[model samples]
Target: VDVMHAAFPNKVPYEIVYDRVVPSMPEKYKPLSRREFLARVMTTLLVPEEKWCLGETKLFLKAGSSLELEDLIALPDEEYGEALFKHLDLAEKKMAAAKSIILAMQAFVYRARFLRVRRGARTIQRIWKAIKLRRVWRAAAERLLEERRGRLAPKRE
Candidate 1:
């Protein structure tokens, strides 16, 4: 309502006799009527025609149109700047939190993968060591058996 009043600085109170009779008198002609003023304001604001209706006594707006109009009214420049800065700050904080969470998850996955690979490598090393030890032991046992057999047959010589 304050916005509407501000749009029409020279608006006059509607009077039936003055409105009907004064227009016919050339000297009393008003260039813009209330309805015409409202139309011009709505057009300038780019408000959709369907969103508003001009009634005899009052202007009617569709649901949510008034809120849209209110939003169209500019805030103080300082307040607007402050609001924008606050919103940006909040968004930055949220992004930072999300980044931290993602990094932690990545670290956990990397550590788990490293441990799994290390365990597999250690198992392979243990198996290889056991195989080498068994081969060496078997070779030593065979050499000892050959020696014993030779000694047992030496008496014939």
Candidate 2:
């Protein structure tokens, strides 16, 4: 078969790359965007809707996940691209915010470890303060991560 030929020139049909997916589907299955995510997990672990007072319910249907520009061709076009653009903007904001929190956390942990090694009280206070900020951001990020993971994970059929 073509797959076997592609995977290994001399391989049998059964030896082809078995787990291969169509190049397009994986990105479509990306977890929810962080704003939608944070909104979802902020109060209850449930995904949000306008009924929940988070915001308009239309957003659920309108929001973007993690698709690349090439993938958006199949996505529904906004009447004028506004809704889709807004959703994408929100996703980008969330990704940037999440990255910032991660960087802050790395800085905090490395600094704390350095201060501990230095063994100075002033350094300890500053490190602990940084650590506290890190913990808060990390907790927020963890909740988002857990929700995304839960959504993306396979479930019993």
- What TM-score, computed on C-alpha atoms, does each candidate reach? 0.50, 0.29
| Cα error, candidate 1, residue 39 (Å) | 33
For model 1, residues 1-157, the per-residue Cα lDDT tens digits are 6535434222223342123333333332256675764555455455688767665655666656655334433445444334433443465577799999999999999999999999999999999999999999999999999899988877663
Clashing pairs in 2: none
List runs of model 2 lying over 4 Å from the truth: 1-80, 120-157
Judged by whole-model lDDT over C-alpha atoms, candidate 1 comes out at 0.58
Number of clashes recorded per candidate: 0, 0
Off by over 4 Å in 1: 1-74, 155-157
lDDT, candidate 2, 1-157, per-residue tens = 3333333222112111111212222343235543453353322222234222222221121122212221433444432134334454566678799999999999999999998887787888899999999999999999999899989998758
- The candidate scoring highest on lDDT is 1
Q: lDDT of each structure?
A: 0.58, 0.45
